[model samples]
Target: MSNSPKKENLVSIIMPAYNCEKFIKDAINSVIKQTYQSWELIVIDDGSRDNSVGIVKELLNNDDRIRLYINEKNQGVSATRNRAISLAAGDWIAFLDSDDMWERTKLEKQVTFAKKNNAEFLFTGSSYINEDGNYYQGIFDVPKKVTYKKLRTHNVISCSSVLIKKRFFGSIKMEKDDMHEDYAVWLRILRTGVCAYGVNEPLLIYRISRTSKSGNKIKTIKMTYKVFRFIGINPFGSAYFMLKHIMGSLKKYRRIKFIN
Candidate 1:
């Protein structure tokens, strides 16, 4: 908050692109418009048949900070993110999905927040938007810090809102699972005695597509259960946590409905 020039932290942004031709441009432009200028965006195309790659290519011609990698065959989101992470050069890594957008000062403010709190893993509150970019009701309510136990029940961390120290990535790897891979990685990181902190400000916009995994309530629950099992939580424990997650989600949506 001071007038003093803060240390320049180079943030590497990882984006996994699929058939996101409609929203990818807005996502990339959000990075280009960031107030904090030192960032390299690594966008990996997961063999999208659409014009997603072409749109990114056109943007690449305009900005040297954005780079694209092509996976000839379609890989899952986790694999795509892992590839981008391998290519990342910055000491700090942030994630921005192709369908999400960030506020201009997201990185700038989050960097300072992380340093102030001495947090290695950090995420901010985010709001949902329609595919057309219209604001949807009810933003997330994030805690100041979440421990492993807390996160097992409520995972309010949005991937696009995260800015993490790259050192933490050495121990926690995203599983190649089709669902809840990010949640699994976050849990793994927290289990290693690190607490994830939240900035408490809505700094990112998560676009909701009708076809997205989140839109299918049953699939979301099934995938979460699978993630719990994949992470080695006992069957009963997984069910307990999964139920809690569902209840929490329902409460969140209920609040949104009230707001609307």
Candidate 2:
């Protein structure tokens, strides 16, 4: 494969919005400012009761690359993302959550890195920002490569940092809203003997929201257990993995710097 930027390679960015009026603008703006220009942003509003749709519409006036779809009812994030994926018209699919922002050169760098490494499934390291958009102290780094076994012990992949080929998705869709839906999909894909390449750059600026599901420690632990079981791990096996997951999480979070 050529190392030069493939101008013809279209990237479909999937963003699911749900009552995120305050942050959606920043999220979309981050995309609008991307150095990689060959991309279309598909924003699906999952029955947002707030002005998230209106904000997206306002931005739509200036950029034809951004498209918005509203859900008839409140479907969860997994379903909303699946719908967006179905509507994607690009060869590569990138995901950006409504509450997160990316570094301006995120796509440009990731695309170049992917091509250089011949990577079909790729992710990057991330830094954190609080709800007020203030930066945290440390970056969340990722290993150079990860497989099914490593990922099961600890999911270091943030959905926002993922840039994968559309063909690899095939029939695999995110499921089980209560668990880590994205993690489940990654596991299923990696189980097929494929490895996920990681770029240890803080390309993703993840927003740490106290209201988000992952913010609740107990709830997240429960969800982690479910993810193990959902992937066909027996009770004993799930318990073993759960212990590893918890220990890994504890160690991971210790390095992160939160707002004082």
Candidate 3:
């Protein structure tokens, strides 16, 4: 790390919005307010039926850092995000959902840690916002350095809280499954033998509404199965991992005990 200014460390943020008119402005502003600069913001519009694109346009007009992409049709979130990734130009890459907001220091903190420890890839901790923007408590039990075993039972990276070297994303084309696409992408990246690390600090605030596509339990279950399958894990182990994850989530958060 030198005091000299160089173009070697540009952090690009890829955020794709769809029908998030209520919160898109705040999300866009969060990036603009970041303590760490030298980043590009690529916001993809996934054929939002609401005023999401318009709000992004307004934000874009206000700040030249923001760029917008309106999809030709209503593609899934995965496609929209991949589009953003394709257009990004930075040494490091991060993803933020349209409905999520980051603390002003989120990028600065995570970038500092990655640079200091030489952890080329890492994810920051995150908080949750109820549909109405109320805070929700999180049960934190993340491993300091994530490996295949840790990720098997649960996913540790929030899409909005991740930052990685540009080489990682370019190596693996993230699959376009709407459900658990990010997780599947991570798994593929892991198979490439890159280590994924984590920061314990909660620097992101995620908005969780019942209307969220990921909130659908049935869909999550199906996606969990699909993600494991894509990695070529054996069917029996995939089923075991899925059950363990669902039940672990139920026990930890839902407070439902299960008996074998």
Candidate 4:
């Protein structure tokens, strides 16, 4: 018998699109090229004032696994993801952003690893790319294992790299769009005594956008503080963690050498 996961191991990929017309097609194409065949792409367009929706529609004819939905208005990322989760039919849930791409074997390798280890929550390391899709010199490394406390100090799990069991969605849903919504969800899941397994390979290609919320240092600081508060950390404790978060962010970016 093959150790490979069966065809029934369907992975529902959640993608929230907004004004990412320039890269959305490439992102979708990356999914189409996945080595794992049992998967579905759920794309929710959050009222993007671009050709993002049109681009997705064009690809619908090529593959039946790709499904597209549109929001009536500009619902935030958290809400959009929640909506997508509600529609997902797979036993495993993976997230991929509209502007990012993945290695062709990302799903294949991650699924195999999860089955071998009996892991419910998993994420992989990422490599960086600029707005123009130029590669950065270094890869963002993730630890072999991450606990709740370790994740609180620094978020090594990129949203686009996560692959989690769908059962956890019963209680874990992304919230608080103004802050790090995905981070909050990951922390919440980990708080339940589940450790997240990490594959330290650059399976994800993260696109660094200057206009993104994380690009604004001051705004990111405020949001990081709010994440602690949202998770029931007191003001003093939040402050302590906030300092650690800042230090971690600095250390993380210092290693990435951008070619552009």
Residue pair clashes in candidate 3? none
Residue 115, model 3, lDDT: 82
lDDT per residue for candidate 1 within 41-97, as digits (tens), equals: 999999898999999999989888888999989878888888888898888999999
Candidate 4 lDDT tens digits, 1-260: 11333434989999999999999999999999998878889999999998999999999777888899999999899999999999988889999999999999999889999989999899999999999999999999899999999999998889999999888889778888889988989999999999999999999999999888888999999899999999999999999999999999999999999885
Considering summed lDDT, which 10 consecutive residues are worst modelled in model 3? 251-260
lDDT of 2 by residue, 151-229 (tens): 9888989999999988877889999899989999999999999999998999999999999988999999889889889
Candidate 2 segments exceeding 4 Å error: 1-8
Task: Tell me the TM-score of each prediction against the true structure.
Answer: 0.94, 0.96, 0.90, 0.96
> lDDT by residue for model 3 over 32-119, one digit each (tens)?
8999887888998878889888888887886777888888997787777777887877778888888889989988988898888888
Query: Which segments of candidate 1 are over 4 A away from where they belong?
Result: 1-8, 257-260
Ranking by TM-score: 4, 2, 1, 3
Question: Residue 236 in model 2: shift from native, Å?
Answer: 1.1
- Who is ahead in lDDT, 1 or 3? 1
lDDT of 4 at 185: 90
Reference-based TM-score, model 3:
0.90
Candidate 3 displacement at residue 114 in angstroms: 0.9
Least accurate stretch of 10 residues (summed lDDT) in model 2?
A: 1-10
* TM-score, model 1 to reference: 0.94
**lDDT at residue 244 of model 3 (Cα atoms):** 79
Instruction: Say which prediction, candidate 1 or candidate 2, comes out ahead on lDDT.
Output: 2
lDDT of 1: 0.87
